[model samples]
Structures are given as C-alpha cells and as structure tokens.
Target: MNYQALFEQIKKKKSFLCVGLDSDMKKIPTHLLSSTDPVFEFNKAIVDATADYTVAYKPNVAFYECRGAVGWRSLEKTVIYIKDNYPDIFLIADAKRGDIGNTSKMYASAFLENMPFDSITVAPYMGEDSVTPFLEYDNKWVILLALTSNKGAFDFQFFEENNKKMFEKVLEKSQEWGTKENMMYVVGATKAEMLSDIRKIAPDHFLLVPGVGAQGGSLKEVAKYGMNQSCGLLVNSSRGIIFADTSDQFAIIAQIKAKELQKEMENLLIEYSIL
Candidate 1:
C-alpha cells in the first residue's frame, strides 16, 4: 500500500496500531494445538478479532522460520488468510534481512513479490546495495532498523564520529537511496525522547515503532515527538496484545487489548490535529 492508503486506514480505524504476529508454537493456547497448523490458526483468530482496531500486522519471520518447512507453510497460510480477508490492512514481514545485492534481491522477491507483503523490515548495516534491492518494488517499503529499543542498541547505534551518531548517519545517508514514499525507519518507542531529533531529519517518513506495551515505551511520548501531519507512526505491541491471555478466550482478550491502544491512539490523533 502507498503512504496515503496507509493513512486512510489509520483515519478509518482511528488508529495507527500495528499488531505484531510474533506467534510462537509453544506459546499458543493448548486448544489451538489440536488444529493442523496451530500458529496460523492462532494468527487467524487474532487477526479477525483485532482487525477493526489495527491498521497494520507484522509477522516476525523468525517465529515461523524456526519451525522449518511446516513453519514456513503456516506463515504463508497466515499471510494469504490476512490478504484474502482483510485486504486493506498493511502486512509487514519483520525479517530484518540485509545481505549482498544478490541475496537481498532474493529476499525481496520472497516477501514483497511472492508473498505479497506491503513491506519488510531490513537491517542497513550492509549499506545501500543491501537495502536498495527491496526498494525496487513499487508501493513497497524498506523499514530500515535505526535506533532500536534494546539495551544492546547502545553498543553501536549511539557510536559517534564527526559529531554524528551512527543512527543519525543512517537516517541521513539512507534518504539518498529511497524516498519517504518507499522507505521508513524502525525507531523504537523506548527511544521516544530522541524522536524529536529523528523528526528533524526525516520529517515525513513513517516510523514502525516497537517496544510500546511490553517494552515499557510510552505511547504519549512517541506521539509528542514523532507524530507528523499524517500521524506518522505504526506503534506495535506483541506479547502485550496477542499473548495477553493463553486461554480459549485469547482472541477476545487480544481484541480488548487492541481496542485499548486504539482508543488511546484516537485521542492522540485528535490532540495532534491529525483527526
């Protein structure tokens, strides 16, 4: 989906929430295990329940890929199910892939071309060639990892040289390769305070922010600094929403959790005059 289409969904749903499908086989409800594909079934239920309150869904690839061929099948089924049922919802393959140009092309084809994801999270460590391949697709996005929320992020992301932090250089240099239309940055919600500086650099680009609920990132702080004229944020919550309850009522609980965030987002949008 294009940027306008994404904002349209946010407007229609009164949310910029992106439900993360970090479904782990061992973590799903015992009831779902009887199903042929527990992970996909768990995802389908979550999607159906929370689709109304979310604008995007991100399926973290590691959760599926770890299970090998069967896991891959479940991932594919989950993707098809969402596209076939909720075509308007943006889908992201959270693969965090970045490799040589040739390898990146294959990864792009796998997710963006063959699987029909609207975007894929990518690591920018390998530089332009590793990222540009994914940007080749029209209306698709490359969500390059920037200042992540993890404690380890400080190990290198904050590295300074010539008065510029490593992530700052990433924010500036990447703009030369992809426009705001086909590119975004993965700015962790835990780093909300730094958002003001990030916005000064990439004012219009959307940010796929993780670390909100489970990671203790404040939603209000994210909006205060990161929000733009279009409410440029896709704040995600995985365990806090999807795994909130592991009983038969998991989906219902997921819906409730999603709605709580959506309502908060609606208020923020209005406060920021994006509504």
Candidate 2:
C-alpha cells in the first residue's frame, strides 16, 4: 500500500495499531491443536477478530520458521488469506533478514515478490548492499532494524561511534538507500526517549515500534515523540494481545486487548490533529 492509502486507513479507522501474529503452538488454546493447521486457524481467528480495530498485521517469521515446512505452509496460507480477504490491511513479514548482495536479492524476491507481503523487516548491519536489494521492489517496504526494544539492543545499538549513537548513524546513513516511501526504521517503544533525536534524522519515515504491553513500553510517550503529521507509527503488541487468554475464547480476548490500544491510538491521533 502507498502512503496515502496507509494514512487514509489510519484516519478512517482512527488507528495505527499493528497486531503481531506471533503465534506459538505452546500458547494457543489446546483445542486448536486438533485442527488440521493450528497455527493458521489461530491466526485466522485473530485476524477476523481484530481486523477492524487494527490497520496492519505483522507475523514474525521466526515463529513459523522454527516449525520448519509445515510452519512455512501455515505462513503462506496466512498471508494469502490476508491478501484475499483484507487487501487494505498492510501486511508485514517481520523476518528481520539481511545478508550479502546476492543472497539478499533472493530473500527480497522470496518475501516481497513471491509471498505478497507489503513490507518486511530487515537488519541493516551489513550496510547498503544488504538493504538496497530489498528496496528494488516497488511499493514493498524494507523496515530496517535500528533501535530495537529487546534488552540486548543496548549492547550494540547504543554503542558510541564518533560521538553519536550507532543507531543514529544507521538512520542517517541508510537514508541514501531508499526514500521514506520504500524505507522505514524499527524504533522500539521502550526507547521512546531516543525518538526525539531519531525524528531529527528521519522526520518523514514511518517507524514500526514494538514493546507496548508485554514489554512495558509507554504508549503515550511513544506517541508524544514518535508521531508525525501522518501519525508515523505502527505500535505492535504481540504476546499481550494474541495470548490474552489461553482458553477457547482466545481470539475474542485478543480483540478486546487490541481495541483498547486502538481506542487510545484514536485519542492520540485526535490530540495530534492527524485524524
């Protein structure tokens, strides 16, 4: 989807919430395991329940990849289901992939071309060659890892280089590879304080933020500094929403949690005059 379509969706729904379908077999309701494809079944119910409250759906690739071929099949079915049923909902493959030039090209083609994901998360540690290949696909976004929400992110992302944080440099340098339309950065909500400086470098780019509920990141603080005129933020809540309950009513509980965030996001958009 283009920026206008994304922004319109945010405005129309009064939300910029991206539900993370980080489904794990261990956490889903026991009854689902009896189905033919439990992962896809869980994802389908969650998508159906929360589609209206969320503008985007991100399925972290690791969850599926860990399960091998059957997991991959579930992922394919999940993406195809989203594209066929809700084309307007921005679909993101949270793969966090990056490699050498040739390999990166294949990875890009696999996700952006063959899989029909609107965007894919990519690591930028290998520099332009690793990322530019992903940017070659038109209207497909490359969400570069910058400041992440994990605890270990501080070990490297904040390392000082020439008096500037490493992530700050990543944001500044990666701009040369792609424009805001094709490129975005991952800014963890847990690092909300750094967003003020991040905006100075990437004023127009969108940010895919994780770490809301389960990770204890402040939603209000993220909006205060991360938002732009277009509400440039896709705050994701994975465990808290998808696993709201381990019972048969898991999807219903997930919708309740998602709507809570969406309602707050609507208020923030109104406060910022973006809606």
Candidate 3:
C-alpha cells in the first residue's frame, strides 16, 4: 500500500493501530489446537475481530519460523487470508531480516513477491547494501530498525560516533536508499522521548512503533512527539491485544483491546488536526 492509502485508512477508521498477530501456538485457546492449522485459525479469528479497528496487521516472523515448515505455511495462509479478505489493510512481515546484498534480495522476493506482504521489517546493522535490495520492489515498504525500545538498544543504537547517536546516523544515511513512500523506521514507543530527534531526520516517513501496551510505552507521548502532518505513526500492540484473554473468546477480547487503542488514536488525530 502507498503512503496516501495508509493515511486515508488511518483517517477513515479514525485509527493508526497495527494489530500484531504474534500468535503463539502454545498461547492460543486450547480448542484451536484441534483445528487443522491452529496458528492460522487463531490469526483468522483475531484478524476478523479486529480488522475494523486497525489499519494494519503485522505478524512477527519469529513466532512462525520457530515452528519450522508448518510455521511458515501458517504465515503464508495467514497473509493470503488477509489479502483475500481485508485487501485494504496493510500487511507487514515482521521478519527483521538483513543480510548480504544477494541474500537480502532473495529475502525481499520471498516476502514481497511470494508471500505478498505490503511491508517487511529489516535490520539495518549491515548498512545500505542490506536494505536497498528490499526497496527494489514497487509499492512495498522496508521498515528499518532505528531506535528500538529494548533495554539493549542503548548498548549499541545510542553509541556515539562523531557526536551523533548510531541510530541517528542510520536514519540520516538510509534516506539515500529509498523515499518516504517505500521506507519507514521502527521507533519503539518506549523510547518516545527520542522521537523528536527521529522526526528531525525522517520528517515525512511513517514509523512502525512497537513498544506500547505490554511494553508500557505511552501512546500520548508517542503522538505528541512523533506525529507529523499525515499522522505518521503505526503504533502496534501485540500481547496486550492478542493475548487479552486465553479463553475461547480471545478474539472478541482482542477486538475490545484494539478498539480502546483506536479510540485513543482517534482522539490524538483530532487533537493534532490530522483528521
């Protein structure tokens, strides 16, 4: 999906919530395990329940990859289901992949072509060569890891080189690889204070923020500092929404959680005069 389409969805739904389908097989309702594909079943229910309140769906690849071939198949079915059913919602493959140039191209093709994801999260530690390959695909996005919310982020992302934070340099240098249309950065909501600096470097690009809810990041603070003219933020809530309940009514509970976030986001959009 293009940036305009994304912004329109945000405005239309009064939301910028991206529901993370980080569905774990072990964590899903016990009854779902009886289905032919429990993971896909869980995802389908969550997607159906929360689709109205969210603008995007992100499935963290690790959850599926850990299950091996069956996991991958579940991911494929999940993406296909989303495309066929909810064509307008943006799909992100939360793979966080980055490698040598050739390998990166293959990874890009695998996710953007074969699996048909609208975007994929990418690690930027390897530099431009690792990321440019993903940008080769049209109307697809590369969400580069920037200032993450993890405790270890300070171990390296904040390290200074010539007085500039490492992640700041990553944002500045990555602009050469792709335009705002096809490139976004992952700014963890837990690190909301750093968003001002992030905006200075990436004023027009969307940010896939992942540290809200379960990670205890302030949604209001994220909007105050990170939002742009276009309401450029996709705040994700994984565990808080998807795992809202472990019962058979989990999906319904997930929708309630997502709706709460969407309502808050709508208020933020109105406050910023973006909607």
**lDDT for each candidate structure:** 0.96, 0.93, 0.94
Question: What is candidate 2's CA lDDT for residue 273?
Answer: 91
Misplaced by over 4 Å in model 3 are none
Q: Model 3 residue 167 lDDT?
A: 93
The sequence of per-residue lDDT tens digits that candidate 1 reaches over residues 99-177 is 9999999999999999979999999899999999999999999999999999999999999999899999999999999
lDDT leaderboard ranking: 1, 3, 2
For residue 5, model 1's alpha carbon misses the true position, in angstroms, by 0.5
TM-score, predicted candidate 2 vs. hidden true structure = 0.99
Best by lDDT: 1
Instruction: Score every model by TM-score.
Output: 0.99, 0.99, 0.99
lDDT of 3: 0.94
* Residue-by-residue lDDT tens digits, candidate 2, 1-275: 88888989999999999999998988889999999999999999999999999999999999999999999999999999999999999999999999999999999998999998999999989999999999898788999999999999999998997889999989999998888898889999987988899999999999999999888899999999999998999999999999989898988999999999999999999999997
| Superposition TM-score, candidate 1 onto the true structure | 0.99
- Please provide, for model 3 over 1-275, each residue's C-alpha lDDT reduced to its tens digit, 9 standing for 90 to 100: 99999999999999999999998888999989999999999999999999999999999999999999999999999999999999999999999999999999999999999997999999999998999999998899999999888999989998998889999998999998998999999998987988998999999999999989888899999999999999999999999999999899898899999999999999999999998
Weakest lDDT window of 10 consecutive positions for candidate 2:
131-140
Model 1 off-target regions past 4 Å?
none
